[model samples]
Target: MDRVLADDLHALHSLVSGLRRDIHAVTAAFSTSWSSGQVEGHVTRVKLLKRMGFGRANLDLLRRRVLRSP
Candidate 1:
């Protein structure tokens, strides 16, 4: 944490500080055999589509987009 915070990159420092819990989760995952990759991929894809459609996308459109996405 100190090393990441000490780095000159502001994005790295901010990301580490802002997503502390996520970082901890990632560290825990690294030592485990189990993976949340599929769930995470689905969530990430949906979030991006939702952001892109924002006000225009209704639930149906979002669902269609999610279904259409690889």
Candidate 2:
């Protein structure tokens, strides 16, 4: 009975290990080149521009201002 239980546990572990490897393969294929670091940097710049403008600008103007300034 003990040997049978051990064999079952070993089979479960192997199945879980294979699933983990497959998940990793899928994730690697779907990973992005643009990371959170770059995104956060752009967000920080946008906030600074927004604050400096004193909340009076329209979206088109703001977009032009942000894009043209740099």
| Pairs of colliding residues, candidate 1 | none
For model 1 the local lDDT of residue 49 reads: 94
The C-alpha RMSD of each candidate to the native structure, in angstroms, is 5.5, 9.7
Tens-digit lDDT string for candidate 1 (1-70): 7888887887788777766858777777788899788999888888999999999878999889889888
lDDT of 2: 0.73
- Poorest lDDT segment (10 consecutive residues) of candidate 1: 17-26
**Where in model 1 is the C-alpha error above 4 Å?**
1-31
State in Å the error of residue 29, model 2.
16
Query: Pick by lDDT: which candidate is best?
Result: 1
Error of 2 at 38 (Å): 1.0
Clashing residue pairs in candidate 2 are none
* Tens digits of lDDT, candidate 2, 3-47: 544675776776666666698765765795645788798889998
Candidate 2 runs further than 4 Å off: 1-34
